[model samples]
Target: MNKDQVKGRIEEAKGKMKEVAGKVSGDKKLEREGKIQNISGKVQAGIGDLKEDIKDAI
Candidate 1:
């Protein structure tokens, strides 16, 4: 995978962990941070996917 894809996946996984930890520990701020991270990861991954698609098309 490209850098964006790899980083996105890592971020997504980390966010998921944080989200679970927040829920377990009753930390709303952590949960929110996790959600934002997850969204950012998804966006990054989408960009990576688009790049790959364009490369293939070309």
Candidate 2:
């Protein structure tokens, strides 16, 4: 996978961890932050996927 894909996956994992931790600790702020991070990661990964697809097509 490309750098963006790899990094996005890592970031998504970290966000998941943060989200769970926040839930366990009753921290709304942390949970929200994690949610945002997770979405960002997904978007990044999608971009990477598109890039790969285009490269292959060419």
Candidate 3:
């Protein structure tokens, strides 16, 4: 995958960890941040997939 995809995956994983940690520690802010990070990662990954699709079509 391209850089965006790779980075997005990493961010998604990190976000998951953060969310779990926050839940264990009772920190709503961290949990919210994690949710945001996960969303951003998904968006980035979608962009990467689109890029690949376009390349293949061409």
Candidate 4:
């Protein structure tokens, strides 16, 4: 996978960890931040996937 995909996946993992930690610690703000980060990572990964698809199609 491309750099974006790799990075995004890493971010997604990190966000998930943060979300879990936040829940366990009872931090709503951290939980929300983690959710946002997770979403952002998914978007980045999707963009990377689209780029790869286009490249392969060519």
Best by lDDT: 2
Where model 4 places Cα greater than 4 Å from the true spot, the runs are none
My TM-score estimates for the predictions, one after another, are 0.95, 0.95, 0.94, 0.95
- The reply for model 3, stretches above 4 Å from the true place, is none
Write model 2 residue lDDT over 6-57, tens digit each, in one string: 9888889888988998899999999989988988999889889999999999
Of models 1 and 4, which has the larger TM-score? 1
Every model: Cα RMSD to truth: 0.6, 0.6, 0.6, 0.6
Alpha carbon lDDT of each predicted model: 0.89, 0.90, 0.89, 0.89
Selected candidate, larger lDDT, 2 vs 4: 2
Residue-level lDDT of model 4, residues 2-27, one tens digit each, is 98899889889888888988999999
Tens-place lDDT per residue, model 3, 1-58, is: 7888898888898898889989999999999999899889989988998898888899
Q: Is candidate 2 or 3 superior in lDDT?
A: 2
Candidate 3 to truth, TM:
0.94
Model 1: lDDT of residue 31? 92
Error of 3 at 49 (Å): 0.6
What does the lDDT come to for candidate 2? 0.90
Candidate 3 residue-wise lDDT at 26:
100
Q: List the residue pairs that clash in candidate 1.
A: none
Candidate 4: clashing pairs of residues: none
Q: In every candidate, how many clashes are there? A: 0, 0, 0, 0
